[model samples]
Target chain A: MTFQVILVLFALFAITRTSRQYRKRKVSLYWFLLWTGLWALVIGIALYPTTADAIARFVGVERGADLALYLAVVLLAYLVFRLFVRQEETERSITQVVRQIAVQHPSKPDETH
Target chain B: MKTIALIPAYNEESRIAASVRDARSFVDGVVVVDDCSVDRTGEVARAAGAIVLRHVINRGQGAALQTATEYALDALNADALVHFDADGQMVAREIPMMLEPILSGEADVVLGSRFLGRATNMPFTRRMANRLARLFTLAISGIALTDTHNGFRALSRKAARELTVTLDRMAHASQILDLVKVRRLRYVERPVTITYSEETLAKSPSSFRAFGIVKDILKDKFFTRI
Candidate 1:
């Protein structure tokens, strides 16, 4: 019972933070909705363990906790891949800008040389 | 033809001057892209009669070469461009040999081949690495050449203008070969001597870094679009 209460409280806190970010315009409406839905699902599973078990059985998973772990792992891996691609893109942009600056102001050799 | 030698240097203050001086003799002008070296690479190159272009931050050799290529084609209006290493390893005397194919309109690009000529003081490990890189290049780009990553190359203005180096580091060498094959640019290899010193060997990328290059190239081939 205490563990269930803790999970619910954590989910509520995350939902609150997500809503705050949405209000501050830091997150788009699409992201806000996705996060809110995710937290609500978490709250529902925490409040009703039977619902998770039912869904897990339907998905051919033995345990609800195991299903959650698998989902989390896949999502984290996808997010990491996205971050790596984004970092490469950012680095390419920086190189392009630096190249332009170097090209514009060339330092010619002195006349004496 | 109006030829310009493009040298991409990073903290090569001691060797940049000699390389620039030697390259200036063969080409009409020498343009050195200083890759934000903490040392006085730019000053030394400039004093050696090279047009110095300074990068605000250190990008990499590939990025520096791309910047120099743009400057050579656009600003200098060069008819041909020679890619020379800032390190004293490459013999600037061979610039003409590299440029012959390009000048005669026989090939769009000319690559230097140490295997065909001489690799003075080259270590056994370096030779093995070069062979492996050649095979890798063949597998990836479907182009077979004696040397895959020689820094000494000559490109016609059209070749230089068409080929773009997107990889910003050691991988750029492989990327250049890939572009040559993809763009269907006529390329030939010329015998050139590379005298490797302890300093040059020390500065070269480690064997482990080859894995990184492979990974970068694979990612570029499959994940990213040029």
Candidate 2:
């Protein structure tokens, strides 16, 4: 019961945050839909913990906890990889712009050492 | 033909002036890219009679070199460009030896190979890393180079214009080999001596960081179109 209560509170918080972002035009419709779908899955699992066991059995896993841990790990790994790629792109663009500025406006030669 | 010597410096305030002075003697012009160094590297280079280009943020040596190359080509209209390290590891007297092939139109690019010449005080770890990098370059780019990460190189106008550098870090040395293969530029290995000091070794990446460089190169190969 306590687990359900905490999950419910967290789901409410996620919904509120997503709605706020949507209202501010910070998130697109596609992202909102994706995130809400993910939240819905969480709520479904929270309301019926037995569903996780069913999912585990379908996948030939013995425990739902193990399955959840595996999925979380996979998701985190993918997110981290995406973040690395994005960071690399940002750094490249920054370097390009910086190089242009450096080339175009070089400092005057100093007369004294 | 106007040959410009390019030096990328970062926090080499003590050595940059001498490097600029020495390089000016060999090339028609000297251009230094100060990569947002905290030290007075820009002022030192400028006072030494080098055209100083400043990056507002700290990129890496690769980015600075790219900037210097572009400036040399666009601003100076150079016929050839020489890539020289600013840490005083490279011998200025050998600049003409590296530039000879490029200047004479014998090769589009001339890469310096320390193994072919001489290396005084090269760390054991660095030698191993260079050998590994050479093997990796062979496997990936199919270019069997004696030295993979040597900074001393000379490129003709055509080669400099054709080669593009996108990697902004240490992995750029690997990226250049890939460009050499892709662009089909005629390149030659020139024997050049280098002196390794405690300061240069301190600036070099550690053996553990080799894995990170490999990862960056692999990522660039598989992911980036460049």
Chain B TM-scores per candidate, in order, are 0.98, 0.97
Q: Candidate 1: give the clashing pairs.
A: none
Worst 10 residues of 2 chain B by lDDT: B217-226
TM-score, chain B, predicted structure 2: 0.97
Instruction: Calculate DockQ per candidate and list them.
Output: 0.78, 0.62
For each candidate in the order shown, give its overall lDDT on alpha carbons. 0.92, 0.89
| Model 1: per-residue Cα lDDT over B43-84, one tens digit each | 999999999999999999999999999999999999999999
Q: Return the TM-score for candidate 1, rounded to 2 decimals.
A: 0.97
Judging by DockQ against the true structure, name the best candidate. 1
Q: In model 1, where do residues sit more than 4 Å from their true spots?
A: A111-113
